[model samples]
Target: MRLAWPLVTGTAAMTGSVSVLLAGMAGTAPLAIGLGVALLGCVALLAQPFLGLATLAVFAHLDAVEKTLFGFLPVSAFKLLSGLTVLAILLNGPRLRRNIHDALREPVIVAGVCLVAIGFVSAIFAEDKAMALSSLQKLLSLLLLPFLVVVLADTPRRVALLICVLVATSVASALILGADFALGVQLFAQSDAATTARTVEGVSRSSGGSDYNPTTAASLMLVGVVVALSHAMETRQRRVLLLMAVAIGTGALILSFARSAALSFSVVALLIGWRHRHARFAVPVAGLVLLMMIAALPLIPAEYWQRLSSFFGGAADHTLGRRMTYNIIGLDLFTRNPLLGLGPGNFVHHFTDPEYRHLPGRTMLGRELHNMYLSVLVQYGLIGGAAYFAMLIAAMRHLGAVIRHPASEAMRVQAVALRFGLFAYLLVSLFLPNEYTKYSWLLPGIAAALHRCNRLAWEGA
Candidate 1:
């Protein structure tokens, strides 16, 4: 923990520098100051919860005089912090270095390397070299993720600390949303005009004027719920903390207005019930949830319901129509470049609306397919897609063992609780696009480590 101080200092310094730069900028910078701040805020929002609230207020008052200055704070912060983090790691080589051979044993590291290789090769022959190179960068950049897995692999207590951070983040976000509802105005807002227009009452999106797309938020909250549940099962003394975590996470997921999250949380809840073997509580809880959902239907703003309802009855402009269009275009792109697909992140350029037979503009009648599987298919091609899917499945199998293994009652239940949260979210992500979720990809690493650790424990026994 003492060694971690320098790394934290470097990270904070970078964040502070970027945040100041963003806040100081005047009119007509390439990066919008407000957008910059909000985006970068995502990085530290977990580390410093109050910062988000501060960003929201600052953004609200920003005008042309300071708009660009503050808009791009988040990006600036991310760039600075990421650079500093890398520098710190390099400077502390002895502390940061790992046995590469040993590290590759983790499934996630292996998958990441494979993906990076595929991306690089695809870039060499890519129809658009720049796009290929960019995708390759993103693929390789995630290498840090596996390091996080390996570091935390042997330390369950550290994992518990991370869970605590997540719980705190969720609670803060929920509190922010609650404040927004009470004020009857969007807070911690971005200038996402699109999100603002579509927003209903009671629930506020993370930022103002931004799309309330809850894919990331929902996924994060679900993970929080899982961690909380896991903690609850592990320690009787922390029951209150665990229960508060569950309530905050569950409440935030609901307030998010993300149907996908709702579905995912439902699955997680069921799994939790089953794991606890509180069979008697299952039916009643389900019934209550159903009642809350139904009661919530009328309570949601009409416009909000209109968007949600469109999912069921289908939206002519969006919902079904948009998904079908994106998939059709994606499939065609996949067919053309089946070997590498269109290069990661290249799909948007290749994507077109079949109905209008044209590329979709921001204001046009088109949007991303609210699905992750389809996005992978379009970006990674069949080969990359297969590798990715296989990796996910393999991780799932490894995680499955965590709960299934014959262990002490408490550990078994803890494993069950943990896996339930992870697996349920994976299943729910089918309908929402969270392809870039750090946790989603990181879970495989965690699972691989867990499997290895479990094996070692058994062998020693």
Candidate 2:
């Protein structure tokens, strides 16, 4: 690993060692520790190509780190690293870097750009310009997400590094979350959810140790599972690493106890198993896959099965019923403002009004439409929805193409994971309005990067 990415691995090691030393330091030393680590990160940022991909591994922690940094720091350290990477590309401006150009040419990026443009235009008629722009800022920040991955993951080598970083982070997160729950401490420092809120009777039903919401933690853990599955099926080397990822991810996901996330995990597992069972493209990894799934099923707490059953009327509840109400309200909004809808960020503004709550079953309006797709349709209208779906469809199609191509078995296997990871997120998006989540935005980029790397390998580049 060190030989493959000397700069990134070395920088990561330095940070990890410094962090450990700082952890044991008695008092005021820890405050100064943050400054030292931030400086190390800055130095890493100067390494250009490796820096961009490495920053993504750290993205999960970057926001929290930004808040802890001293006021004298000029910018978001993560953003600064990303900006430096882009500047390095501009300076090098060479033929290989033109991979960025080709990456931009992917239909998914085109559709995403169209979607962003449509959202920006919709903001023009927004009820509140300031609020609309604020929402747009977040949306636009995410819209460039795939491009960020594309430029950094331009080569197969970098994509491998990206996967390594992602999987390693997931494993570390699991250890931290699990150990914290066992020790009854908020060991992650940044989660900061009060003792009562984070744990119930000393059992953590979330990644309470980390920055991710429990729901988001479930989704992240699902990502680890999917990637681990792909790697397990595709490669012979480091099978232990893959198994470790699967175990940790599953444990975290179970602790998260998110019904939709659990369902998504099961569906993705089944799909991968089925995909590999067919002889033409099918590999012989089905037995282990089935065993893994079967083992995972019993690990879930009994109450979670009850929670999943609620989705299908095992116990009719207000929250389940409210989703129906949300659908009705969303459709009504779409019908009235069909062309452009209520504009960006208008779902919450429009949905919370007393008048909207006058439905037969619903006495109170929902806080927001908890459905991301419906919310997008309500905000950006039909055109935006079309562009959004088009992007997703195109991305899915590209992955299929990559899988069918004659790349190395390893690339194809990982592509399988990338495809299913995106699918899992799509499944969970149905129940949560996580349209701007890093999970949703980052996936298309990773999938596209996988496809590009596989294609390059096939072409003998």
Candidate 3:
């Protein structure tokens, strides 16, 4: 999969750096460690696919880095790793030139750029220009995501590896969450004393931090469920790993007590179950899931249960009421600035404006519309929203085409999972404000990458 010198050189450099750090660099140990990690990561990036995998792994598990000695050192490891990964590809030069061209040509990738351009232009009118620009940066980071995915997961083997990395990371997080569930405490947040814990009813949600708090954690676990389920259906060899992932992921999810996540996970599970109605594994897995559900039934807090049952019983759900109010506010914002809306990230600032004082929302600061679609609609208006929507539609169509006319067995398997993932994320977006996050864009990148594979022979390219 790669040459030997990059590894050898990287190892030697890292070793020599450690030697120096042990001698006279102890005073600047933090800086030394950060530099060493970056160097080593760059070397790993010599193998383009590994760099991408490492980047995604770091992205997925960066929250858990708090367990490390230098976790709280403000190292910006994710940014460093991602930047180095891209740099490494550039260093590959002519070898990767064609791949780079292919990645850029992806419709999803083009659509993402257009979407960002619209947001960038919209930011000029932002009530808080700085905040809108800040949000744009986040969206811009996401735009680079497809290139990374294409370079890393260009082949079937790499795509499988990608899912494996996600599964392993998700399981680790789920285990942490499960431990918290059993001990009734968030041991992971002990380092960040100032980090407020989010709890529903008497249970503490498994929010590692603001980046991956309880809501995000639960939603990610839901994504994990899809990946694991997809791999399980794709192969019979690694049944145990997939089952363990599904089990741990389900446990972690229940603990989060996130209504939207729970509902989304349930819908995906049912859909997958129906899709695999004739498969041999479906029956047993379904039974195990049923058992897990029954066993965990009593563990569900009455408060969460009431929230989940809101639709059936018409219970007065506070969260629902709040989201409704916030959404109405978003509508008003869109109506006023119907062309461009409040700007990319101006919603929170405008939410504080005097004109919206009559709305049901009480607090203005740190306010989110709850619905990502509505958020995009309010901020980017119809044009930007349509561009983003086109991206999603393109991804769905690509995946659908793959399923209908897959180039290979591996392509079919991956397409099935990614198609489900797209729907699952879209469904969860109605509750979770995830439109701007890196996670939202990564799946589409994979879908586009698969589409590219169908056209170009990526398998042994």
Candidate 4:
């Protein structure tokens, strides 16, 4: 009993640690905590039957705290995990930190840290105090995202597992979204109901704008497409099945009616075809294009069609008009506060009025910024934008290294395809805001892990 007691306690502690980490990375606390409890209960019931209750009680307490804190604080669980990781490093001598010496040595990390600092400092002079506070939260949220990526994505196995988890989440989210739309339930909140309704209607006709977010759904579908493509290249028997799944995901992306997603998918597909010269690849690609066109034919409203057509720079595309006007306002804001810009998240608050002088319907009252680059520029200033770009350049350089020296056939194909996928995402990001999404950090983190593993393979050779 005495020996089992220590074991039980240690197991409980470790389970909590694991739960905290998974919850931080995936943003799903209850599920992770449940798994942790199950693990603990299974262990305790076998050795110390009486300890099962105690373990359950501990799990319950943690779950309660998770529910309460995560509801109010988006980063509460993440901060807990960060604290735990730091504590572990302090105790265990920082072994993981030594694994990615190159990533650590890269100057981008320093620049990014400095840019984040400047963002906070600039917030003091922000035009609006409330806007500054919100911006501060956003800045901190985004800054922590990269750190989360670096800390959690330290190994190839972890990277693969992350992808698998995201795939599962995407699939589940799609199903939930479908059900919500069918049931006529509000499954998501959107900044613009009209945009959301149009996008959702394009994807699913019988049901629309359930609880699912179109942008998030679009991003997930993109991930599914990339993963399915990777799987098809590696697995012979499942190749067709994976390709079919990719088609489904692409179809879902179309249903999303996220113009940015459509643009991203098109650009990424072309890049992949050009990179590999796989003419057969065009078969699935062509199928998806046909599917989108077919879907768009009956479902897409005339206004949406007009909006898309007006993308070529015409008076009819009020969407472009809004974006162009936002850019002009963003530029004006940038010029005034060139050093720090309008706080970390205050650009919209400061520039929403007067900037839309021509359009009475145009208002930037919320966090919505159609363009990622302009949004970052207005919020973080040129200094922060430069730092962000530097980090991306470093990441791209690392990916380039992987393509030049792939460890295996699968690795080479995955690396090349992922590079194109990243490019696709960047292209999509041009039309929408995406620097703060979960996928944003996960992709780069996975890329970094792949890069590290390739180096290890080369060293072994």
Q: All models: lDDT?
A: 0.56, 0.68, 0.72, 0.56
Q: What is the TM-score of each candidate against the true structure?
A: 0.70, 0.80, 0.87, 0.72
lDDT of 3 at 395: 89
How high a TM-score does candidate 4 get?
A: 0.72
Q: Between the candidate structures 2 and 3, which one is better when assessed by TM-score?
A: 3
RMSD of each: 8.1, 6.3, 3.9, 8.3
- lDDT string, candidate 1, 247-271, tens digits: 6666656556666677777666666
Candidate 2, residues 1-461, lDDT tens digits: the string is 22333554466667766765776574656656665675566445544555765665556422333334432467755556566666545544563356778867977788888888888888898786776787788777676667777766877677777766667666766776677656766554454432234322234554533455666566665776777776775666787779778877777766666677788888887776665575543543556556876978876667666666777877544566776787788888899877776787787676766776676445443356768899889988999889888878877877898889847766776677677777877887887776766667677777777787787777885
User: Could you give the candidate ranking by TM-score, starting with the highest?
Assistant: 3, 2, 4, 1
lDDT of 3 by residue, 114-173 (tens): 889899889988878889989998888778777688766766667666656566767777
Question: Candidate 3's error at 21, in angstroms?
Answer: 6.0
lDDT of 4 by residue, 1-461 (tens): 33544554576668777776877589887777766765554444434322322222221112222333344555544444444443333333344456435555544455556766877777777777786777566555555444444444554555455444444444444454455545655343333432245431233321122222465446545665766665565446467666666655655555455666777777666655564456566577567757876875785445445444555753244455566666677777778777667776675576557645565336645435667787778777888788777766666676788888877766665666566556666667776666555445445655666677677778878
- Count of backbone collisions within predicted model 3: 0
Off by over 4 Å in 1: 1-76, 79-101, 184-186, 189-204, 207-212, 226-237, 274-308, 314-317, 353-367, 406-414, 456-461
Looking at model 4, the pairs that clash are 135-345, 187-210, 187-211, 188-211, 203-255
What residue pairs are clashing in model 3? none
Clashing pairs in 2: none
The candidate maximizing TM-score is 3
How high a TM-score does candidate 2 get? 0.80
